[model samples]
Target: MEYILLIILGFFAGTIGSLVGLGGGIIIVPALLFLSAGSSLFTGINPQVAVGTSLIVIIFTGLSSTLTYMKKKMTDYKSGLIFFIGSGPGSIIGAYVNKEFNLASFSLWFGIFMIFVSIVLFLKDKIKPLNQSSSGIARTYTDEKGQVHTYSFQPVIGILIAFAVGFFGGLFGIGGGSLMVPAMIIFFVFPPHVAVATSMLIIFLSSITSSVTHIIFGNINWLYALALIPGAWYGGKAGALLNMRLESKTVVNLLRLVLILVGARLIYQGLL
Candidate 1:
């Protein structure tokens, strides 16, 4: 029964994470903490363990979704690799710092992160991209529906933001998609499909880097991880398929709603 619960949890987390580029930690970490607090077989998870376990699970989630996105030609592999320049080391550093969090504090801080994402989405159109006049790094993409998008970002700023996003992702075990995806769409003017697809690529790589540090800290719960991976794997695939079927604006609107709800839950949990 405990394992069944974990499988179900993993499936939902993966689906939600992959569907909206959240990377699933937003669901998994909190659920683990919630489950641990209950009188059940899943118990005794500290924040560090939860974060570490979530990071590893995100790897499979990212991989499964990414592979599906690849077949559809949706992922921006080159851009993902470029952004990793900063996110990789930042993730390592964040993982090392994860030891500092307690359960309540982690929820409080992560809730703030969620709010930040919501705010960004709300103001995305109002805020202009950095150095809008400067075509620092530009690219063009045409989506499955033959919609063309040409976007650009200042290279240095892009890398730095990625590092910050990676740090937060590593700190919270969320794969940084919450911040990265919005930044891509708003600042870089990336197409929604491209942003979601590329963000998963970065998530997969950053998770690997962060997970190694967690492994060294002995923060992973191997049993829970083993139970979660298979479900997360398949859910990721399911989510990617669903995402492709939806319109870009619809995806963003849906993501916005989910972020707000998730953020509220974390904030409420933290206060209690």
Candidate 2:
């Protein structure tokens, strides 16, 4: 029964996360916490352990979704690589810091992060145009639909934001997609499909260091992770397909709604 519930949760997490460009950690961590609160099997589960487990599960979730995106030629490889490079060291640093901190405070602070993410998602449309005026390296990419998107971004700025995403991702046990996807769209003027696809790729790379550090710190739950994997894998494929069908504006609106709901839940949990 517990395994069944975890799998269901994982499915939802993967579907929602992939749709929004997150690595599913945001959904997984919170759901785990909620489940643990009432179940004997997960009773007294440490928040850090939940975060670590979520991160581990995200490895598979990210990979599954990224492959679909790759097939669609939706990813921006250069930008993804840039973000990955910056995120690597930042993830390691953030993981170490997370391990060193008190779990209670960290869980509460995660609520704050969620709230901030909600605000960012809400304001992204208004913000994207403001950031597009600055010119840097130009990029032209063709999607699976054969439509070409041409744009430019400030590489240094994007790298810096990626670093910050890595830090928060490690600290909060999220894939950083909640922050990174919107940041790319708003700050770098990346097309929505490109942002989501590229964010997933970068997340897969960045999570490597953070997951390793969490393993060293003994924070993972292998049984739960294993249970979650199949559901997440299947769900990711579903989400990737949906991503192609949805309009960019519709995706943004959906993302905003999810972020706000998740943020509120985290805030309420932290208050308790």
Best by lDDT: 1
Model 1 misplacement above 4 A: 131-135
- The candidate that wins on TM-score is 1
lDDT of 2 by residue, 1-272 (tens): 88998899888888888888988888898888888886787765577788788888888888999999989888888889988877877887787787664545655678778778778877766764434544676777776677887777777777888899998888778878988988887877778888888888988888777999999999998999999988898888778889889988888887788877787887777777
TM-scores for all predictions? 0.97, 0.93
For all candidates in order, the CA lDDT equals 0.90, 0.82
RMSD of each predicted structure: 1.2, 1.9
Error of 2 at 120 (Å): 2.0
Model 1's alpha-carbon lDDT is 0.90
For the record, the alpha-carbon RMSD of candidate 2 to the native fold, in angstroms, is 1.9
Runs in model 2 with CA error above 4 Å? 100-104, 128-135, 143-147
Estimate, for each residue in 89-178, the C-alpha lDDT of model 1 and write its tens digit: 999999998899888888888887898798889898898776464658777888876878888777778899999989988999999999
